[model samples]
Target chain A: MIRYSRRAVLKASAAFAGASTFAIPSIVHGESDRIRVGHLTPLTGFLGALGTYATLGMKLAVEEINQAGGIMGRQLDVMSEDSVNPATAATKAQRMLEQDGATVLLGEINSASALTVMQVAARNKKLFMQTGARSDALRGKNCNKYTFHTDIPNTVMVNAVGQSLLRDNMVKDKKFYTLTADYIFGHDLLAAAKRFFGANQGNLIGDELIATDVTDFSPYLLKIRQAKPDVVCSNLAGNQVTTLIKQYSEFGLPYPIVGFNLNTADAWAAGDGNLSGTWPTVWYHTLDVPASKAFVAGFLKKYGKPPENHAWIEYVAFKMMAQAMTDTKSTDTDKLIAYFEKETEFDILKARKAHFRAWDHQLMQEAYPFTVRPKGQANDQWDFIALGTAVPKAGEPLEQLAPTQEQNPCSL
Target chain B: MQFGFLLEQVVNGLVLGGYYLLISLGLSLIFSVGGIVNLAHGAFYALGAYGCVEITKYLGFGPAVVLSPIAVALLGILFERFILRRFYTADPILSLLVTFGLAMVAEQAIRIVWGAAPLSASIPPAFRGSVFLGDFLFSRYRLLILAVVAAVLLGVWLLLHKTSFGCVVRAGIQKPDMVAALGIRLQPYMTSIVMLGVGMAALGGAFFAPITIVHPAMGAEIITVAFVVVVIGGLGSFWGVVIAALLVGVVRGITIHFAPAAGEASIYVLMFLVLLVRPRGLLGERIEKFE
Candidate 1:
């Protein structure tokens, strides 16, 4: 072993101490070199298909932002964790804030987990961008000062579809047989559908709250056959959606189908092009806009498939956050929130710009009616659904699709 | 509800019962013959489904349907010789814990290989459309499921009751030491029984794969239902499991017609009621361990 002089030892110790002193704060606060973003989403489980796409969208945004000289000359770094459930989400949110020193938090497809993350964000005073959950409570009773919702909520989705139903002459005095999933998310969506149908003079002949695990939809299908409804409004989620669509097709029921919330991935999974219906969608891959085309190209280059709505929500969420941070020239949670509340517009790949409402922290974006092509008429595998312009007519104001200030009364 | 609808519900219940019968039969056999709670039974089912998917992609649906279960059964033999054989003499709880750990690893491995998204196999051309039976319409694929399961149940019965290998297996389950003292080795019989039980579970998975969503968590989803069927049927009794599975399927189907949300909940309620009345199960036999 070699022995060192006292002066050398002292100098070495000083250098080590100096290096650690500078490195520790950088890890916590993310100095001028990098900005830490904590991404909490389900990377595994039933909702994982959408979650994985959402993570990809986050990555795409982070890469583009870093390449374009990220917020205040600092690069963006995302630390992702699988938010499996509400309990896991709450603990991870706290750990992300305290242990990881994350300056911002994003993601959550499950509404219950989103609510938990929202509470954690409020308590920690960190800016949390809610990405995938579509519960109306997030914009109403559950809305908090710290959280900002980027996806379209249940009420907005219903209202958009309701308008389309009236315009397309599908809802006036029409009888509907509703098959709602038996869960909190399903209950909320059913409530929204009821409100829409009630307002539009639609009659519900049969209503069934189906358990999520119930694979065979035949019992309910037989009921629908007896009830003879005009259309069967499906408020189902997860694999339940695929099951219903497949079984319904197999049954050869003549009732027109309409879905409140249908993911792009669900359509793709219904192989042989079985899924077909007029659905209220937030965004489709086939939107004829520059941002959408560019996003589709870049996403295809990286992921080898067109981005789904979950991917769109996550990609748009990061871009919107980065825009706010750049505009304010700061990542301070309060300052950025204040800037967000001032009605800043974001180009979210739609024809019109989307912005956060001052009252509720909801993103006011364009909603469209999507119709899937028939199996015989399909061009490519992913070219299943196309945007319909009849219902939410071209150039229809986005404000009309969402609830007014009086309806929500959200006070942050 | 109309009488026609009620009749339709009965048919539906019977079809659902067929799946329960297929799944619980294998679990009951393994528990009784092997004396090890094979918690990885569902994982074997999942592997069978994934195997079917992979095999069908190249060999088409016909050959996949015939060969996937056999391939998974061979895998079960390897699993028994290497992993399960070590825990044979240990406490039953050790086997349960070990199988549970294996199940978790298998599910993760499936995710790593097949990805986390739900996948579905296209229904074969032969079973694509519906066939009308009298006034009611029924899925042709469902009819195929009922027929296959019925034949399988009959085959299992004949094998266990008529064959010499099955006789040795039964004797080993009841009196391993006595069977050994008779100048006969039971290790091969135990290995064969495990293979048969696991292969039966794989057949259930292979057939159900075309109808249901084949995902990673499918094993977790089916395991609880299998255990409940086993417990409610009186653990080791083969006919008890069959009767219980049928009862569960019919009750669930009927419950969906009356109260849609009560379909799954009613099964557990029935399980609880059965356990309360007879802790051993509906047809449970008092089991004696061979010293």
Candidate 2:
């Protein structure tokens, strides 16, 4: 065997490591002409199903934007990947900004993950158009200058459903037992729900904080039955909501189930006959607006299915980001933030155009409370829920349901 | 009144334990016979649920549940022949890595075929709702799962204890060299054991699909709990797995009743305590190969 000198070995290894560093940036930043945007969402775990839809929606928007000459004539190169969890999300966001050369960040359905991503964006001084995560805290206490939230927050969802409950006269003097997901998102929602109850005459007799991975809700169901509450409210998120709903139906508890949070994907996954009661949604494919109808038709044509709310939000967010880049003539984070801070309205396929609230950077838009259609009335599997009228009605300010500056601690 | 509610949780836990038994028994069996910790066991479980969902469209829920497990077991034949057969006498780490890779591949394969969204499944109308035995309420579907688990456990017990086939399998587990010296090939026995093991996991998946969210990662979610049961029951102890499974379920239910946040953590805690007391598990026996 031939042996080399120790100095030679060290020299060769150092050169190789140095070569790798040079090679990596060249490959990663190969397309200097294209504008890179980083997209992340939970493509695994409980929120994974919704994340899949979010990716699809982002893809569709990217395709459309490119076809329409892209953002400021530079084709967008969106690097979409699974956020996995909050810690992973933050790490990925940091890499996307620093290494991947992404000018802007987008996409997330999990609130906790979104918060971490927001922190990363703030640290990097990058723009993050948070697409689907709806925790009020993300907009309230955790809000940052670099992150703009698109989805309605937890308080909006609570008020949207709370309005329906009030109309049905179910809130006053009602004894409520709640099952909350044991996470930041769920805790925020539970706080919103408690606030709603406290404002109304509803009594929160019992509430259980459920671990995210707990598949069996039978024990929780038993506890609910024992409480004998007038209403059972769900503040659980992702597929946990579906599991809880299915098991709740399985137990056939007398108390009607309602929730402060329920994504369209989660609601659909509950199946037709099993789902009942009112729930809040950011958007539904069945919205009657012309642009909304066109988006749904196109999504159905391409995907062979209607777009979920997460999908709609991601699509709209990408479109708005593209518009921002076009109007501002740059992908610079500070410029984009300034443009959004001007509160320029963008058509989000809703009855009214939405704009970022200048103070908190929360998207001021319409939220809808939905209820399941009567059995056998649905045209197909996706058409099970009947969308209610948009909250705040036609003449009212879009921010009517959102938390005020007094309630929210956000300063940026 | 509090005691009555606690009793309800305990009873419910036992029923839940029965479901856990369906998954862990097969895991325990494969480990006993082949000494290969099948990390991809949960993949078969996920396949069972997906198979059941696919078949339910044409054949209804009753036929789907039965056919899904049978179909997955047929796949297990190939699994044993190609993958597991080679790794039996090799380094255990190799088998573990191969199976872990296979589990990821299976999850991705499922994601491709079924889409990333969870497939919707519902309990049959007859099996919906709860039944009250005195004051304690039982989900009608869970009771059906209990019956199926009991039947499966009994059938597996009779097959393992009474049959001549089991004798060779048992003999193979205890002394592989002796069995080879006696001119008996353990290959066929190993194949059957794997088939039965994965089939049981699939059966658990099929039954649980209605109650749980039927997603691609559901297999990964369940494998952890299944492994915990297998560990707590100890290696090579069928009765040990059964007792441990029920004990885990009861413990989880009780924990949820008292401390809802720690319901999922309670099982690992139980596993920790049991391992601390008896490292080999509650009923684990000493087999020559593992030692």
Candidate 3:
């Protein structure tokens, strides 16, 4: 007798249901007067903490916009879904488009999920403002007309951090040992960092690709000891940061450390004041900019803690999309895309003005390099990172932070 | 690699193998003695780790380490009594499904209580430094882990080989009807053994917590690897589990030194090779109940 697996049965049924539903026009379930924004982020997996903050950030933005008379005199309506994985993300994106009547789609933390969401957005001809997936490929080889990324790509992050490190005399003549997460994001980040290091005449002594679910870093730590590199660059993500930093400090390997991108949530998880080294982020709650100060105060008064980098990006992405729609007075995908590409000059909660680069629809915003606050200098538990270098010193001029035209030639 | 560095890698392998030994031992016991497939043993492990982290905040580290495993063991006792006991005489697949659901519940419960972000416990001040052993630097905490695991393994061996409880358990594994005919209450013995197995898993969690991050999904990560080890060590053999855990751990350690990318995949490769050679495992015993 042949037995079918539960997953296969469910997939078959979902395909049948989806095909049938696609034939019918979407019925708007939300308030007819409100403009619906479908917010899809990983709200329940390993990235759940960041995703929760992302949801809160978007909620705060929507409320502020609605209170201030939302775009084109319509209140913003949000339909949130947990983008669990790529397959589920694609399914949910289709559901949002065909059943929920979401006029705009945004918010995805995983790059793979964001790619799938981008595909759905392009297929439906809806405006998608991607919040936080750092793969440069989204703006490069996979560039689509309907999707716009508001987060810094991996190439930008690596270049920004690398330039800052070099200017600080940190990696000019030093040997570096790197432990990278073994996946698409990690591979992209490592490649970008290698390019930056190669340009700066730095030596890469050893590099190891670590598994995503690795709980032990001792083997890699031992190898680090033997290599005796002057600096250690960890290109790992999520809880890998916590495990590696804690174990690194415990092992007492005396090397200055840095990260390509480190989330503030991970810094908090590395409690007992174990968070060390310099890191770069698109935004942080402790930034000294006026807009950042306002966001931090508002988020703190409402949510009881400052917003993380992910939260900051989500908040900025929604506000940018909303402001663009208001300026153009149209929610048409072509109008929004043309408005952003040709005439959109927006405040990105930074000191300088940022705009969507025409070549690639990436939000060319300033990146912040932060150092872990010393134990005595920290004012509170979350005040763990402070600015390492002034803005625009390393991450500026849209052309410098991102890849050159020769490297990322796009036809859009 | 230099001799000293290679030796350090071996030591690392031993520490990792000791951990796999404790976790796989619990999986092996639940399958062998109770004839129940427990997929949630790793959840108990996570509970033990998170319990230790929370307890350390109120009590000191020593008391936290001691009480965490006991708390998890009590939870195991309750779980075995209420949920697992119902499926004891039922189809084994029922137990697998029940435990798998329990695992999901435990993971979500942990998320609600502890939050989804990964949390870590710092090493005790006493175990902070490294031991300089003539050209090699070994972490003192890892050495302590190795010693603690060795003692636990030795104690377990003595319990299984040199006691009347061991005889009853061994006899029950092969001939539960004979043990029942001899006027012994097998149900209580089975419950007690289940508690012991789960407690060992918790103990491993408590010890390994300082070295690793304590997250809700950490248990799920280890459970799959533990199941692989159990399968490769034979379904219900005690010695088979011990040997397989160490072998897998050392091989993984060496593989990381050579090819870091293949380190995780190498465990499955080893499992495949072992199954090809000995379908029942390295020290698999012929158990008529499972057949």
Task: Identify the leading candidate in terms of DockQ.
Answer: 2
lDDT score, candidate 3: 0.83
Ranking by TM-score: 2, 3, 1
Candidate 2 RMSD to the correct structure: 3.1
* Candidate 2 CAPRI level: medium
> By descending DockQ, how would the candidates be arranged?
2, 3, 1
Off by over 4 Å in 3: A1-32, A44-46, A67-69, A394-399, B1-3
lDDT of 2 at B266: 92
**Better DockQ candidate (1, 2):** 2
* DockQ result, candidate 3: 0.53
Better of 1 and 3 by DockQ: 3
Winning model by TM-score: 2
The digit string of per-residue lDDT tens for model 1 on B29-62 reads: 8778778889999998898888988899899987
Model 2, first chain, TM-score of 0.95
lDDT of 2 by residue, A60-95 (tens): 999999999987779999999999999999999998
- Tell me which residue pairs clash in candidate 2: none
TM-score-best of 1 and 2 = 2
**Candidate 3 lDDT over residue span A1-412, tens digit each:** 2356899989999999999876645446436777888899987655666787788899899989999999999988888989998889989998887777788899998778899999999999998899888877888888898999888899888877777787788877789999998766788889888888888888899999987778878888988888889999999876788888888877878788889977778777777656677788888776778988999899989988788888888888889989888988988788989998894788878877789988788887788777777777878777768776544554436556778778885666
TM-score of each: 0.92, 0.97, 0.93
lDDT for each residue of candidate 3 in B1-291, tens digit (9 for 90 to 100): 477778888877877888888889878977888888899999999998898888998997789878988888888789889999888778787888899999999999998887777665788888986888888777888788788888888988888789998888888888888999999977787777788888888888888787777888888888988988898889667788888888888788788888888888898999999999999988888888988
